[model samples]
Target: MLDYLKKSFARKKARRQFQEYSHTVSKFILKEEGEIAFANWNNPLVTPKVISQEEVNFFKKFIPKGALCIDIGTNIGDTTVPMALAAGKTGTTIGFDPNPHVYKILEENVKLNRDKTNIAPFPYAITKDEGEFYYHSSEASFGNGGISNEIVSDQGAFQLPQKITGINLEKFLEKNYRALLPKLSFIKVDVEGADKEVIGSIGNLLTKYKPVLVAECFTRATSEERAELYNIVADLDYTLYYFSDFDENAEIIKLEGPKDMNRWKTFNFYAIANAE
Candidate 1:
């Protein structure tokens, strides 16, 4: 009876907040776990969407054996685990996710695959500087959001009150993952909408290592922002491939130039540095 009343009250309050604020209330406590999850944006019902998948095989084909890889915004370690496994026990896959709610689950998943996969999880947002900053959640609910940009929804208050530190990815890797730099052959960035900033912060590494890059051009981002993503990678001599789905078999639309990007929909794109 007590638990029922409590849950009933919570639901009523949630509805009230949704109606009043427009954006769903951000709930920080998240429970349960899944092998895979979709880090969707503007979801008021949940922060990270969970689904069942016994195996993650999409990244194995992209990640070479015994090669180092990195996954930014690794919600629940879904992509991170596969990258780690693909890299083999001899290699390492470092994942960075600042969302504490999901980061906890990622940490647990990392442990479960420790025996067979080399994984490292960090609860920090990737940025150009090493300092504390605000982490905002747009259209959030019970734990979901993308990027720290102050994008307001139809609801009044979309930015949640949370602080996450920014880590200089290049410096962090140089200081810690130095030994593995030579083997850094793959990098995947799915940080909502800050893909370019993350890429820019590590520009030197990308230039030096010339790793395979996979980044999401977020649906909420502006056209210029998406175009810049193209310019950044193209300047580095990468051939771009855009795909709508995460499936390895999904049809790919090759991007010939900046004008070809269709930002009306959400998509993940990949690029390979032209072999020197």
Candidate 2:
């Protein structure tokens, strides 16, 4: 009973800290091999240097110059900026984020690096179809935002449901990026728990471009949903590799099959197209 009370107190204290940080905004210079200017509220734990340096290194090694890339769930341009830089001036990095509040930050961050990187920010959510949906934007944790049809965080003290525009990936790509499809080199997805939906919507694009795909899978998805995601990649003739970190030397464990992911609650993975 005494230990339980201590644990409860600790949780309450952590919650208080989260609330405090949520209302605070600050700017910092994020430095890894390169430097990025960043600002954030409610996300003291995130910075370009810490979470994305390894990813940047990995992209530098794999993504060719002048490549076209996509960044889904581009929160404040942390990953987008690095990818844009890696893509060089001739290349373009398109980013999507539906949360209005955070999308503003994403825009600002993109502008902050405008002179150095080629990044375009889109204020729309990627879904299986075009429509409007309620976005659950969490106040305490900014990254927990998700569409009404998808799973979102329930741990926050407060959340606002804001109606946002959703874009069908296939249709949008056809209309806007069709000409660049051949140059598409990489696609990064981190749409909370809705990765499967996004991947499903872009089946044709994946088949045509066969860009390297990096996606985040949440443990909250059902076993069937997980299987569907794995099958989708497999059907595309892509080999699966689990991403252990952003480090250039991060472990890239190849999975023989989808069952290999059953035990992890959340994991990042890479899907590389098999040679034709």
For each candidate in turn, the TM-score is 0.77, 0.81
Q: Model 1, 68: alpha-carbon shift in Å?
A: 0.8
**Candidate 2: TM-score?**
0.81
Error (Å) of candidate 2 at residue 251 is 0.6
- What are the lDDT scores of the predictions, listed in order? 0.70, 0.73
lDDT tens readout by residue for model 2, 63-167: 677889999989777678778867866888999998665677677667665555788889888888788876664444444567765444562344544568999
Q: Between which residue pairs do clashes occur in model 2?
A: 54-246
Cα RMSD to the true fold for all candidates:
7.2, 4.8
Model 2: residues >4 Å from true position, as ranges?
Answer: 1-34, 42-53, 137-142, 149-161
> What's the C-alpha lDDT at position 58 in model 2?
81
Q: Please, what are the lDDT tens digits per residue for candidate 1 over residues 1-276?
A: 999887666555553353322221112221222233233333233344332222234566677778899998887675776677668777889999887766866776676545557888999889887877656554333244454444445323445467677899888998998988999989999887778888888888889999989998777767787789889989988999987665556677889987666634678888988888
